[model samples]
Target: MTETTPYDADRARFTRQAPARLVLCDHAVDVADGAAGLVATEHDPDARPGGRVSQAVQLLELTERALVSAVIYERERGSSWAEITQYLGIGPAEAEKRFAAKLAGWDTAFDVPYRLDDTGRKRIPQLPTAAYDPAWACTQLDRWAGNRLILVDNEHPVSSGLVMAVPKT
Candidate 1:
């Protein structure tokens, strides 16, 4: 089961702190194809070697932004800002300035509780088995910040693991 998975997890539950990026990525894009899409998009870049690295970093930032908002949505449910910041790999002050304060402007509806039971106790939220609509996440993603979500597949062996986001038009 784990072999076929795009992500490797150390625990089955979502911790009080933010889960690892691969785990969260797997959780956000639930469809196997979508997960594959994320992976594909992550690797696909029009830029050459140096440009490719920059683009990849941008895609990474986009993923972090989406994941941060997702975690913030969960925080509204009961999680703490401290845990979210930790997951974001930032300190409280920086988190407050760049992340936590942005929640009011973000789309709250997508901030659905990815977990239903106790995350810190006996029950932890596991990666979603359900499929997610890419077009929908794309459109909804626009609401969050004009950022885009992309997943492209080709005939080659390319496997992307990130979604690119740009400022909204």
Candidate 2:
């Protein structure tokens, strides 16, 4: 009798090379199931509550930072205001109003290439554009970074796409 290894070398290699984070946000039921499984398997009620609280708080803080970073990174990467607005689930003006304070100190120096019409009127929307604010961006970036997971909405362009923005140290 021969014994075979369970690991698939090809799949492991592909995963190792992929640069982006694979966030499975689509299918709320699947996410909930996964979360439930994790919670059930990873946590023990007998464990000290203090430790759990501390870990939760730390995770929250990290998530906030990752959210902000991801927003800024996405802006830098040339995402559109419309896209941003959609992601934020807010009107352009409202989103800007909410995040103005945190963005005040940051420079909107980054340029994004976008074609306005079929003729190709390339223009760069101002950094921290109305759609995204520094504070909110920071919060989102932190959230994404902390989660180390991606949530994919069926409506999003990249259905089942992964999005992870780890701040380069």
Off by over 4 Å in 1: 1-27, 30-51, 89-93, 107-169
Model 2 lDDT per residue over 33-135, tens place: 3444435535666667576566556556555544554444445446655666788888877866765654443333221212245564434333322122222
Name the candidate that leads on lDDT: 1
lDDT for each residue of candidate 1 in 24-119, tens digit (9 for 90 to 100)? 444454333233444555555654667655655666765665565466546544656677677677776777677645555332312332333556
**lDDT of predicted model 2:** 0.39
After superposing candidate 2, which stretches have Cα over 4 Å from the reference?
1-47, 108-169
Question: TM-score for all predictions?
Answer: 0.33, 0.34
Model 1 per-residue lDDT at 130? 16
Worst 10 residues of 1 by lDDT: 1-10
